[model samples]
Target: MRSVNYARPTPALAIHDLRKSYGDLHALKGVTFGLNRGERLAFLGPNGAGKTTLIRCLAGLTSADHGEIFLAGQPFKSSEARQQIGFVPQEIALYADLTTRQNLEAFGRFHGLRRRVLRDRLAWALRWTGLEDRADDLVGAFSGGMQRRVNLACGVMHEPRILLLDEPTVGVDPQSRQRIFMMLDELSATGTSILLTTHHLDEAEERSDRIVILDQGMVVADGSLDELVEQSVGTQRLVRLRIDRPLSAPIRAGVAEHAASFGATGEEEISTRIDDVSDHLPGLIDLVRRRGYGIADVQVEAPSLHHVFLHLTGYELRD
Candidate 1:
């Protein structure tokens, strides 16, 4: 029998041939990926797509039956590996009776920080998370968003090299979400590699350096935003045109012929996906004029990450 060798660390986080199963259900099917130093990547998928399972395996909260995980160029099973990574779980992990400062102090000490260092780290983390003014307030009295911020502060107080965040903005308000994004942006600037899992498509598009879309324990797509869109949806652009007069049958047929796909709203507006806008727009205008109709407005919409997900998986991400 050939024994599995698991000592290696090439990237900030690397998993090869990772497999995990729970009795009859397969939670992860050989999931593999690499995150480089200072990279911000988003893990995107519907519920039950194994995103949480993968995170647990990396965090050592669960053991993989087969496969290997490496952190910072070393086996992830080691204590050194665990110390190098910080995880903010989907659930709020904090002591309700503890103050914000106390929470950080407790977690910092768990990582074996000295008392003096722990205090300094607690102060800095409170300031960094914008909880300096509320440091003495019991967590039980804090708002949901404030608690979420403190949860993250506790995980990151020691300045770990990599951060794994699982739906950190699930229930937060818009302002709190914005604040968290701003903080993550600052962390990225300081060269902290971050792997976040979220269902917020717009937020992921704006924040992640790369997006990995998973479905049914498989990676359906992975790349930068533009690359994934272009790979999945081709070159067609969505266009919506509003006309002064209702579309005649012949004009509608003409529009369909010029567009790869199109739909009409009785007669006032037409939405279409076309290959070449410059080539198709003039022809569309000419057709409207010939049909005794006038063009009132035209709008073009690019394919978003949502559309790309649908195109690749044939189902909405939420479904």
Candidate 2:
């Protein structure tokens, strides 16, 4: 097995001015981004937003009409650069009739892994994907989640330095999703750069090192969650608190002083939009407590990637 150096500082992937089109219809328009070694970059975009085309271009499945790509500082179009990348598409690519072990073996062989290296990779892939117990079982007999894991395992059998995943956890249970993230985390720890395209906003916010959003075949937004929030919604945070009962005149006045606007109202619930909840919530809670009112619940709403997406792109459905 080849050793991976986690301390390398070079970027694992880079693309500049990538453009693709199908005659009159353009798929990607001047998209540019880079993935640092061992980092997890989440790619997000609306339907028909050039995400699939970009992924296909990076994986060499479809050549970009115009662009420059580099893998580990080498020309991405070269065969040597291709060896450093792995792709796990949204669909399951393994043969259902093949046993789990057989499927992995086939992938390993396809990657040109042989002799002791192939055996070791086969063992490691099964164990890493938690399929050791089902190694002899046919893939057709496994659950959807299990099949997803096998699909992921096959993609990385060659131990590529960079992995690209598209909707890897779609339709899977929470447990399976957690396991897949954990495996990806381990891979990142071992210096594998990852570019993940997922619809799960929470996962992208929590798991990714950086996030990029594309719209209309162009790069609309790219940054961390905090940066994106600041760009989209400024320094605002929503605070929803439920008091024991309706707030009195004095309490309402106090809340009004801190709130820019009010939201949904209930008998005991108060929703206020504040500039920053982290700085004001403690004071508000304390004041409510001093007024003989017990707080039942509190929810802070921050600008999420989903919100930014909707704000940037209209809510109309796309084909």
Candidate 3:
């Protein structure tokens, strides 16, 4: 029989059975996940969730005691891995005295690019950051948004296959934040896998291709927002109403099972779970009229990551 070769594409990055600790405290516990080529993953966790520990391990800044990290399907080696990973820490990392071009050149050389190649990368970085006009100016003189661009541009001068970002838009204005994501979108077009950690729930929900939540050194949830919502909290939304005055006992008694719960509660505002807004909202409004209860206000809270995070991780404040 003729042999047919069927080769599988390697993932951009993978962590398997990862474990790390600090004395009696466990920093990571059997953590496992994968980043497909060109995928954008939002890594989320509350304070002290060991997010920093994992990022350090992957960036070669610190070693993991037990887990194996794979880059392009091969075991990680410091020298080889350096070229495959790019890290942009949350804090700005740049020399205040150095010009934008100078900083780019220095960072590019650090990653082993030299001579003509380094010059070409510098040109690319300038364009990528939209700081071409300010290339000759010291980075310290630039505004927060401009410096943030340089911070981001420095990390990608070598164009690694994987990027790790910690709050990539932390200090920039809204316009700059939008521009930053635009730059990220361009990088994504080139097949770079990104893993970012941020407390901005809205950004994670909208921008990330997938979400991985960590709590107490373990993976609590991993999936799209809808998928995680369905798994952890179900799809029901809460519909709340504040009545101008309480419903009389006779009116309360007349409420059917559907609207009865709305009146049974002793509070001025009552809420109910709804599966569909279009089908359920009209009836609820009608019930308010039939009972002669004036609705002062109404609110609907959808099932989202905010709910999911609190659901799986609990409401207790994390120090």
Candidate 4:
């Protein structure tokens, strides 16, 4: 096998103005992104939104009609580039007849590892994936989560600097999903740059350092979670209040002037959107007290990633 070097000091991955088309359908419309060493990015989009296509391009499994892809500051089509990157597909690709350890050994050898290196990788991978006890068992006998773990181990056994994962946690139980996230965190700590694509928005929100939201083969939003939420969703913050008595017309008009929109005297509570909740909340409470209304409760709602996606695309993230 080729000598795998984990100590290289290069930009983990880079893509410049990538474009791909299949007849009338444009799979990728000038998509571009770059990742530094040890960075973790989440590629998010709905079905047919070019997430898979972009992954395929990065993996060198699909050729781009236009644009350039680089790995470790070198052309991605080079053999060295292919050897320096690890790809874990959405589908579990493994030999059912082979034991988990055997599968890792086979892939390690395919990557040009010597017998001794392959043995060491096998042990490390099993331990890393929490499958050391199940090493000798055939992959066909393992549960879905166990098999998924093995699938991940296979990709990382060679210790590629850049790891590309396509929906790696799909169809797994909550426990397994959490385990996968933990393993990813470990990998990142060790300086492995990861580019993962998934529809699991909440998990992405928690784990990703940067979120890239794609729509119809275009990048609609890209930034930190808070940045995306603030940019896509309106700046106005929502505040809900429950008063002891109904409000009068003048007070309602005052609120309307200060707020973008408001509804009062509801069956449960009064909700309004204000530019600055911190400053306006006090005035609102004081007005209610002056009107002889008792304050029951108040709740403030800030913009979330879900709300950001909805506002930018006019559809839910899952849709």
Candidate 5:
């Protein structure tokens, strides 16, 4: 298998000036981004931020008013080009009445796989979903998580070069959500490019190689976590120290001239923002100790994806 995180000569999927509209309401406005080969990208947006619309446009489900899409360095046109992309919608698109094996068989055949290849992949899908023991069980009888796994297996049966997942773990429990990501990890290890949308910020923050945040149908932020933080939210860390008593006159004078603004929130609370913890925290501690002040506790909060998202978009990702 090709190494999962290696750089490629070109992006697996490239979208430029992708725009769509419904009457006067614009669903997408000049959206543009690229999905690097073998990289997992989080496409995030709030409700009605055009994430779903962009996905639909790329999947060829909904026509965009204007845009250019490229797959593997060529203009993305024709059914053959479409064949290189696999999309899993947020809804569980499966026949619940059908048995797990039956569903797999149907999906494989729909993908135009021959009997022998379909048969081999059927077993692989069943095993990959960890539903081999329940192969004959009806998908409707399975839990939401189980049904989701089957849904995922059906979409990827053809092993498309690019995978677009919409809310892959939306309705599932935590354990199943974890399992779903592990399954995606296996796919990524085989060098599949992934672009997934989810309401879960923590998952996006933790799982994605890069983040592209959309707001009001526009690409608002795009970069790694640290890059986003530095670009959108400054890198200063908030430090709050709870001491036993107020600072002495001498200690207050010593720290008053510092750029971090060592100020007392209360008789026992010292609050400041520091650029470097190792260089600043110990000095503050020693300064307090030398003055015979007792330390109670300390808290340091660095900027996170949550902070960057809020700063850039100015709205919590509701829905």
Candidate 6:
């Protein structure tokens, strides 16, 4: 008799062969990925890249045409999986006339949290959002940032196992954005999985554990910043040097020999595009200095996430 092998426990979320369509349009084309427990994954892409469709399917608001999603080892279509997921949309959903405490209590009850559990969750939600002092005040009376915080607190009131956030930091002050991320960090520390979609590249690059880039319903790139940069942009770095005075024609020719390409930007500034600035910069600077010019300024710009995005997806604006 053959021995039986049980499957390993699934991660917080596993999406396989996700496909969705609208008439002639294929929104998601066999999308597949897995998110680890306590991981923060940022989903990014150009407009109309199926981000909304994917989120809808994950949140259980819309059924996928063909796919399978498992949450914490349970089929995503099951009630158990649905109960463990929390969603925070771009638009605020709290009742304006209700107080912060009232909103949380209503959400907690709707999630079937009862008695002491509801009370404890509500108190923690208020304290986590720094809304304990304003618990009795109407949500409409709060600032945009405060209201955003309330909106977040409501989604988290049930202590969900996984959270999906869509542009949670949109239209808020920097301080509020910081608080929102801090709150998310705390949740992640407690072992909650997070999936985020936002247009803020810097925020995604800074906060996410891993990033997945979708373009026209396909996974074009997936990895950390260093990994993506190495694959897409190579080891190149942009170096700009300005001198007190422009070099003579012969001296300019000498600088060009050491650079992949050198061009005059301003009166005394020259731009050098090179791979591994550390190797070429010293030589280039010495070459320029020997020609009787003082180095006025030096600027080194690295390839960034934005550059990688534009590289994979063109610079044309998407509606």
At residue 227, candidate 4 shows an lDDT of 76
Local accuracy of candidate 6 as per-residue lDDT tens digits, 26-52: 999988887778888889999999988
lDDT, candidate 6, at 65: 90
Candidate 3 on 1-319: residue-level lDDT in tens? 1111123377788899899999999999989988878778899999999899999899899888898999989998977878999999988899989999999999999988999999999999999989999999999999999999999988998999999998889878989988988898789878888898998888788778889999999999987788899999999989988888765542342445643446553456767888998898878877777777788998999998889988988998998
Off by over 4 Å in 3: 1-9, 249-260, 263-268
Query: Judged by lDDT against the true structure, how good is candidate 1?
Result: 0.82
Ranking by TM-score: 3, 5, 6, 1, 4, 2
1-319 in candidate 1: lDDT tens per residue? Answer: 1111223346678888788899987888888888877778889988888999988888778898788888876777657767888989988999999998888898998878877888888878888889999989999999888998998888888788999999999899999999998898888778788899998998888888888988777788877888898898876888777888665553454344553323443568877777888998787667666667787999988878988877776764544
TM-score of 6: 0.90
| Residue-pair clash count for candidate 3 | 0
**Which candidate, 3 or 4, has the higher lDDT?**
3
User: What value of lDDT does candidate 3 attain over all alpha carbons?
Assistant: 0.86
For candidate 4, give the lDDT. Answer: 0.81
**What are the per-residue Cα lDDT tens digits for candidate 4 across 47-144?**
88889898888887888889998876887775776677889999999898999989999888887787788888888999999998988999999888
Residue-level lDDT of model 5, residues 1-319, one tens digit each, is 1224436677898999988999998999999888888789999988889999999888888888998989988888747655788889999999999999999899888878878889999999998999999999999999999999999999888888899999999889999999999999888878788999987999998888889999999999988888898998889998887888775543453444542435543467777777999998898887777667788999999998888888887865545
RMSD of each predicted structure = 5.8, 4.3, 5.0, 4.9, 2.9, 5.4
What's the lDDT for all of these models? Answer: 0.82, 0.85, 0.86, 0.81, 0.86, 0.84
Could you tell me which residue pairs clash in candidate 3? none
Each candidate structure's TM-score, on Cα atoms with residue i matched to residue i, is 0.89, 0.86, 0.91, 0.87, 0.90, 0.90
Poorly placed runs, candidate 4 (over 4 Å): 1-10, 234-236, 242-261, 264-266, 274-279, 289-297, 316-319
Model 5 residue pairs with clashes = none
Superior candidate under TM-score, 1 versus 4: 1
Candidate 2 versus the native: TM-score?
Answer: 0.86
